[model samples]
Target: MDAAVNTPVVVDSNDDGTVTQELELEKMGSTLEEAIVETCSMPLENRPRLPRITLSKRNRAVVKALSRMLIIFLEASRDLCETDLILFGTAMAVCRIIGAKFSTAGRTTAQSSAIPAWGIIIEERIATKMDGGGR
Candidate 1:
């Protein structure tokens, strides 16, 4: 939908200062709003945060690498129309998002049926809730 989006979810820390999360996702065809509502309706204790990663300092580098891969794929597939390129890009983004949502210790690929639009909204809701910026 939009060019940029962000979503965040914060899991309250336990007595040991660890956050545990149990995300519940609906089937692929469901609306993004519905997915967000479901995620929000869950109990706060289920949204615990995993331990911070020392290699997290390289997060930006990882993103840059992925972006470069997208660019390379686009360049290599130039015979395809602009629409195809756009769709491919969106697909990559969607995959990235799914990975973020289900990932426990490392990145994971999301099924293509999960629309990017819904992913954006989910991310926004998570960010808002985590940051205490919900409307």
Candidate 2:
């Protein structure tokens, strides 16, 4: 293969029976060439794209609450495996990344509640929105 300029080749076919060939060779590094060939040779169907997330606010709040619960479970419970901590850390990271905020602006009736009542309230609000206020 002869090294040609870095221009994308266009192969045009005629309606009438005629054969035309255009090949462009690129001067790429050994690793890059290998990578390109490997990537190109792979079946397009097998190369899946990332899935989109369409999370509702209630879902976000639930996820956040679950993360908090997991953290609590990890902290309060004894004899947790190293893997549990890893999972908990990952969940915490995700909750923070989504930026699920809980309203702590006002003192609630259950302000002295020990079981993260604020987080629960936020989660309820989120759940309500997700459910279209069904309840």
Candidate 3:
């Protein structure tokens, strides 16, 4: 899904005496979108500044894919710490993406390269969403 499928169930008491569980898709999407915005926009003192040659053409698409994946993972998760684990786990993927996007002819080792592309990944991720393409 292009948008996040998470927001979980909301328990609300009606003006009457009935209680209900509401699956508010819009609310969930907006809330998750906000969370994503907050997470991505937080400033890092040591954030890397990738050169123009190192940027990905698919920055927006890749970030959309990754965010959707994260939402799916978050929605399916049971334990809270799993969320933490899943979030932290993307570090490897980000490095791999950086390596692949800016590959040198034959001298690049993403595993050992010190490119510091911690994002453009994150920047591109949130940047595109808030730009013209995102909902």
Candidate 4:
């Protein structure tokens, strides 16, 4: 999308009683809804599937932090692209990795490996999306 084409106009009154017109430049890109739909329509094998585990206090904290970071990034940026989606997925993968490491601290190596495995799957899916050559 052309950023210049989608610039927003703003009008302001000066102290001298004169009006000024300004162009607020913004990045032009797809909407969040469109991005979500594109993400959801990905093949099952190319999607992240985090296991259903009870959220511990630490896990909850990590989730909250990651969510806030994602919201901030989304709000501050104008364009939403596949790379952004991949970054978001990577953040989610990191959260899973942290949860898996903490939750499995006392478990067997095999059991503790589950979360990391899921994280790897999610990373692979993101990589596939990145290289699949489509938006």
Candidate 5:
């Protein structure tokens, strides 16, 4: 996926003659929701199968509520920094890319396989963040 094409860029000019470019990930949330819905609606045989994971309705409701709360928090924060926006954009992009890869793999392969690349990438990111004290 081309970030330039898929992501929306917002340019902010400060009074100090500095410019900041922020990528808005909220816009991609709706598209990701649509993709999730479409993936869920696929025929049983066409969809990827995970053996042990299950999200209960209550858990899902909680997740949805928390997601809404997070969005609201992001909106209400006047001190929102570029790093926050960048992290959100990166997270959304990773999710979408992983989802696309899984969907493609489901269509091309007979059996579901572990996403080692994405898993390793996420682990490394987490480790880096931890090492940097959540910089």
Candidate 6:
């Protein structure tokens, strides 16, 4: 092994003294939230040519809460492997690149039942990708 590889070095730091990995991760999460909000706020004609998804207002709140819970789980629990974090973060960025908002905020329920949360959806996607790319 190289001496440099064995050496302990501070990878991320600053004079502000706020440069820990978790702090950076938290900043990333906030940026994600901002991105989601911004993309959701955009007009349809201005959005990309791919699928532009929308959800009812209440569903939007629920999805946001579920994703926040997923983030909490990813950080709070040590169960996830390093690669899993990459998948989760990329999934988030893509969909923050993958935002959602109802073109018209709904006055009624999106559905009568609560099932298949965003975390579950993400889990399924990850599993499929890890399992070699088929639905």
Alpha-carbon local distance difference test for all models = 0.37, 0.37, 0.42, 0.41, 0.41, 0.41
Best by lDDT: 3
Q: What are the RMSD figures for all models against the true structure?
A: 20.5, 21.8, 19.7, 20.2, 18.6, 20.1
Model 3 accuracy (lDDT, Cα): 0.42
Worst 10 residues of 2 by lDDT: 19-28
The ten-residue window of minimal lDDT in model 3 covers: 1-10
**Model 6 over residues 1-135: C-alpha lDDT tens digits?**
011111111233333322234543454455444544444555534443233445544324333433653554446545545434433333334344224322233233345334458867887889998999875
Write one digit per residue (lDDT tens) for candidate 1, span 1-135.
122122222234443322223231121112233333333444433432223333332333333333443453456554645435344343334333333332323222356534588898898899999999885
lDDT score for candidate 6 against the true structure: 0.41
Report the Cα lDDT for residue 15, model 3. Answer: 25
Measured by C-alpha RMSD in angstroms, how accurate is candidate 1? 20.5
Ranking the candidates on TM-score from highest down gives 4, 3, 5, 6, 1, 2
Per-residue error at 100 for model 5, in Å?
A: 7.0
lDDT of 4 by residue, 21-131 (tens): 321211111222333444445543455543454565444433443444455445755565644664545343433334332231232435446668778888788998899
> How well is each residue in 20-129 modelled by candidate 2, as lDDT tens digits?
22222122122223323333444433432222334754334334433443453346545644334434333323332333332223233454464587888888899999
Which residue runs does candidate 6 get wrong by more than 4 Å? 1-20, 48-135
Predicted structure 1: lDDT: 0.37
Clashing pairs in 6: 95-98
Error of 4 at 51 (Å): 1.2
lDDT of 5 by residue, 34-101 (tens): 43345445553564332222354332332343354355435544664533443343333334422322
TM-score of each: 0.22, 0.20, 0.29, 0.30, 0.27, 0.25
Error of 5 at 41 (Å): 2.1
- What TM-score number comes out for model 6? 0.25
**How many clashing pairs in candidate 3?**
0
